[model samples]
Target: MLLLALLEAAGIAKLGASIGAGIAAIGAGLGIGRIGSSAMEAIARQPESTGDIRTNMIIAAGFVEGVALFAVIVCLLCLFL
Candidate 1:
């Protein structure tokens, strides 16, 4: 991949990969945190809609986690291959 090539040329492929993975994890954490915060606020505002808010929050968190996992896997591959 072009990205790999560039990193290799710069002699920091492993470092880059590690940093990328860390960033992905941090971003996911932030995204999930925001989702939870918003969901709680929404639930507080509308107690009767707790079920809907919780469901949407979980779904959004799952999506963010999935993306983070994919990013981490890609970074690991880049580090090893």
Candidate 2:
């Protein structure tokens, strides 16, 4: 009985981890998309500052990706450990 309970708990943990990872990825994608869209609008308004806007957008996207990656790693760790 204890063994069965432990197996069920592990299964639940894996499911939770997968769901968390999916949420993290979706959040990151939305964040990056918004950043890109806003940057494009800003560049359209002032074409001369395109370089600066582009640079900032890339940096923001990188940060978002980094966060997403960390979340995914944590989730995977939960599944394995």
lDDT of 2 by residue, 1-81 (tens): 776458657688788889999999999999999999999999999999999999999999999999999999999987787
**Per-residue C-alpha lDDT of model 1 across residues 1-81, encoded as one tens digit per residue:** 887688788879989899999999999999999999999999999999999999999999999999999999999998888
lDDT of each: 0.94, 0.92
What's model 2's lDDT at 19?
95
Off by over 4 Å in 1: 1-10
Poorest 10 consecutive residues by lDDT, candidate 2: 1-10
Instruction: Give the top-scoring candidate (TM-score).
Output: 1
- Those runs of model 2 whose alpha carbons end farther than 4 Å from true positions after fitting are 1-10
Q: List the residue pairs that clash in candidate 2.
A: none
Which candidate gets the maximum lDDT versus the true structure? 1
